[model samples]
Target: MSSSAAPILLLALAGFLIGGAYSTWKTLRWLSISLGACAVLAAAGAILWLR
Candidate 1:
């Protein structure tokens, strides 16, 4: 490949990786929230059952 094309290709790859990482981060954040909500509900149910 030509030198000029290499730089542009590398930059594009970097941008694509950054975008993928950001989306993964967002997905994890939502996943954690869902897990936390489930945990809280489970605890509440257990407390009520014990009472």
Candidate 2:
């Protein structure tokens, strides 16, 4: 885990969570789906960072 990567990883995770929540609340089903997908990608990136 390089120091440089930490911020980006954290940002991605945060964005994913925030976007997912907002999309879900906004009642836009398609956007919610997209946001969920982003969340998955963010999680994968986090896992890769840990490795």
Candidate 3:
């Protein structure tokens, strides 16, 4: 569970960034956050499969 927590925390942080970007109307920031979320999900999936 500890091992899984890091990527989940990252995903949550990226989600917050996305929300903040949306509020500020920053397109690049939103895009970066979207990518960050995707990366986090991928990493989490990989970790789950590996485990």
Candidate 4:
């Protein structure tokens, strides 16, 4: 894997983990929060990749 991709992947992973924790506490809204986190991570990664 390219070094540049590594940090983005790590950001995604961190977002996922944080989402998991967030969803766990607020069960009713878990999916939205988790998916939102993933989306945000992807967007951030894309922006960084473009730079």
Candidate 5:
């Protein structure tokens, strides 16, 4: 794998996690929040990885 691939995958994972959070918000508040937090961390990791 290339150096850039990891960050790119991280971003994609963040996107999926955000979507999962949104979809689960109505029925699973706690899970949604957890997924949102994870998404944020993934996004932050991606940004830091690029640096």
Candidate 6:
């Protein structure tokens, strides 16, 4: 993978995780929170990777 591609992939993964969290919020609060945390981590990773 290219260096630029890594951050892009991480951001995409973050978007997917955010969507999963939102969808699971009604019936699975714990899972949603977990997903949200993961999404935040992924986003942070992407930002850090870009720097």
Across 1-51, the per-residue lDDT of candidate 2 in tens digits comes to 887688587667868676676758667777777777777777777667677
TM-score, candidate number 2: 0.57
Q: Whose TM-score is higher: candidate 3's or candidate 4's?
A: 4
Q: What are the per-residue Cα lDDT tens digits for candidate 5 across 1-51?
A: 799899999999999999999999999999999999999999999999999
Best by lDDT: 6
Clashes of each: 0, 0, 0, 0, 0, 0
The TM-score-based order of candidates, best leading, equals 6, 5, 2, 1, 4, 3
Model 4: per-residue Cα lDDT over 1-51, one tens digit each: 997787677677667766665666566576766666776777677567757
lDDT of 3 by residue, 1-51 (tens): 686576676666656655655665555766766666665665576566556
Q: Mind giving the per-residue lDDT tens digits that candidate 1 earns over 1-51?
A: 875555455545555544554565656876555555554555455455445
Model 4 weakest lDDT span, ten residues long: 21-30
Tell me the spans in candidate 3 whose CA falls farther than 4 Å from its real position.
Answer: 1-27
Local distance difference test values of all predictions, in order: 0.54, 0.72, 0.62, 0.68, 0.99, 1.00
Error of 5 at 34 (Å): 0.2
- For model 5, the local distance difference test gives 0.99
Runs of candidate 1 exceeding 4 Å displacement: 28-51
Regions more than 4 Å wrong, model 5: none
- Poorly placed runs, candidate 6 (over 4 Å): none
Give Cα distance to truth, residue 6, candidate 1, Å: 0.3
